[model samples]
Target: MQQPEPLIPLAVPPDWQDAGSAILGGDGVRRVLVLGAPDAGKSSFCRLVLQQASRRGRPASLLDVDLGQKQLGPPACVTLGLADAAGGVPGLCALSFQGSLEPLAAWPRLIPGTARLAAAAPPGLLLVNTSGLLKGAGRRLKAAKIAALRPDLLVAIGADAALEAVLADHPHIPVRRLARPAQAVRKGGNRRRRLRAEAFAAYFAPAPAWPIDLAGLRMEQAGVTPWPAPRQLVALLDGAGHDLALALVEAPDEPHRLRLRAPRVESPVAGLRWGGLWLDPGWNAHEIPRPPRA
Candidate 1:
């Protein structure tokens, strides 16, 4: 007996097509969640999938929920438009709850709305982009919530150990780990440079924001202090119904920490960065300390 061929070399969606390849190839509608750490290329992967779907004469839409950072926009800071990429299909209809004032307080009302919008959309493939969280029990809880949504497929990008671990714990959902294009680039001088440059360009380009609820939330340029200490921040986030990115944190005697917490998960403080600076909310100075890894 011969073994079956693996589903490698997945098809890419085409340009100017309606319905994504996933839907076309499936017996029913397909819904996917693209999970990854910050800068893990989840959005890019989604675009590739949409492009492949387009190529196959199928239409798909992305439901952006990375509200803390508006990576996707109609007037995209980057070249790709989520809607245009889907052949003008409506994409990403909600905001992420991160950075919003009282996101936890507002999530109950907001998530249902997002679900309703997703449910109302035409049958096809629906892709969701998620945020990266630090390590902790909080991150685990967030992953569990997302899994509860029952995405037909889940794709985890970069070093998202926590997300992958949580999804794997479920045992019923299908998951895939995608490689970064830069990592796939053939090693050498010119090609490597070009690949790195392209990746950088894509990284800097503004994308759509994660759909989150911010009804009672307020944005403050200054970092949180006194009330939400680093540990408290972690706990608050662990308890929060919405996702939270530990943008910057400042402690009087401790090394400044930049923490990113997903809806219910808490990630490590050391890995987070903004523009090469170890994002220390505690460090108010314009200049940030460089990590030893950098």
Candidate 2:
């Protein structure tokens, strides 16, 4: 009998051990979506998650779908070393945008691409990084389309109002927010920067909630709000150790309503906004009440 060709051994990255360990601890989540606004730290968050997985010895594939920035690949613009390290895994594959919306605008085409890439992924996990589009109706539509793919986890980075809005409509999905790393950079010296980084890291290590006085807020659509001064409310929520998700507002005499899992709370703050409130990651798509049939 002819000798069979030897199977080539793949080179595992140095950090693969750590990455694998983290993957084993999670609930066998195979697919994830990294979402947020531009510069909202989506890319960095992706790196951190993948790096952790790689360090634990878990091999996961990454797909970069941020067509607007094309942040994942080279001509040596963005640092894609994380993707490179991930590629070393035996069954991993990473795909980057060619820097255009035309490719992503066609949803029918993108779905097959995601499926094909996922098929080749290792049994561990697959992470997809999406663009951070905060404004415009088109951007919102695009985000909604992407969310329909139904990844196991959805991570939104930075001030991602749009994703928060979308999540209000699809509440059952699991979504997490990651803070930006650059916020750790110090102006004066390296020592300061390191200190700042450590401080910021500590702040994010344990997720916190911030409380807001939502009195007097108005709802424009079902489960959607248009608070003229949202920053103050956001700060209050942050202060309460809660990460701000989407804000739900209700104007007096407005028939539009929000269907939150919990009952409404009466706020002491005068002009407080909102109808029903739920913490981020607390509610999912299934929790959202369905609209009445005509």
Candidate achieving the largest TM-score: 1
- Model 2: weakest 10-residue lDDT segment is 1-10
- Report the C-alpha lDDT of model 2 over 2-78, residue by residue, as the tens digit: 11112111433323333334444779577777766655555455555666666666666566655333333311011
After superposition on all CA atoms, how large is the RMSD of candidate 2? Answer: 21.1
Residues 1-294, candidate 1: write the lDDT tens digits.
101112113442232122234334766447777766665555556656666766666667667554333334311111112444434333433322222322232244335534644565455677776545435654564455464456776676655566666666666766665554443222354543343234223322332222223234332322233223332222112122322232222232333322323222233212221221121222211222224564
- RMSDs, each prediction? 13.8, 21.1
How do the predictions measure up, each by TM-score? 0.46, 0.45
List clash counts for every candidate, in order.
Answer: 52, 44
Instruction: For residue 230, give model 2's deviation from the true position in Å.
Output: 51
